[model samples]
Target: MNIWESHRFGKRIHLTYHALRRMEERRISLDMVQDLIEKGTLIHKDEKYCWIFKSYSHRDDNLVCAAVIRGSAVVIKTLMTHWQEQPE
Candidate 1:
């Protein structure tokens, strides 16, 4: 688990154990996660979860996203790459 107190956003963000493992497997760095949380587009949200997306120039997987649970402390559940927007 990893915790970041984001002064810019005024919230504590936690990367859960599962999220950490996924991040490593996906080759997603901590800095990328931070940027996603801070600047990514909010593509979906419900009462408890939010999906944030962003496009990066460095990778073949241009779009990456993060699944996060919203609360006093935002918990990042997972990270994904090569994300495609599904038809609603």
Candidate 2:
């Protein structure tokens, strides 16, 4: 299945295929994503997507980010490390 559900902080989060692949490639685990969803800061958000960023003690990357489309259920669009904030 391209979409799967994960629970964090009693909220249902859905990961898209692209998000899963990026997670694997970036070596970001499901736990990391869920932790981020629970604890990360909301950096930027528009009508289409919301970006969450957090620093991990185990990782060297300054920050890990998840791009999510929020609704009744949050759909994680992708994940990234060493994220540099871009201007809108």
Candidate 3:
């Protein structure tokens, strides 16, 4: 199954310990994760590509999700957030 299928709320998603830690560290909410999976633009796709999207929060931080679909599960490898620099 692809990452989309594996990310179904009813389906199973396996977040690696590192991913979980990163999410927590970045204050990423489950809603943000879901938003990325559902609405984020796919920048690239190999085994998987980093999903880039704005966070659901008001801060609108840029979120990058790295995940791979394994069997019936979506294994999230890591998550990162960055502030977009405003152009003058």
Q: What overall lDDT goes with each candidate model?
A: 0.85, 0.80, 0.58
Q: Could you tell me every candidate's TM-score relative to the true structure?
A: 0.88, 0.79, 0.60
lDDT of 1 at 60: 91
Off by over 4 Å in 2: 1-11, 86-88
Order the numbered candidates by lDDT, best leading. 1, 2, 3
Q: Write the per-residue lDDT of candidate 2 for residues 1-88, one digit (tens) a residue.
A: 3344545534468888999999889898887887788889876477667898999988998599998887777788999899877877
Instruction: Tell me the lDDT of model 1 at 52.
Output: 85
Candidate 1 lDDT by residue in tens digits, 3-73:
98865458899998988998999899999999888888876567788788899999898689888887888
Error of 2 at 40 (Å): 0.3
Model 3, stretches more than 4 Å misplaced?
A: 1-11, 45-52, 55-57, 67-72, 83-88
The deviation in Å at residue 8 for candidate 2 is 7.4
In model 1, which regions exceed 4 Å deviation? Answer: none
Clashing pairs in 3: none
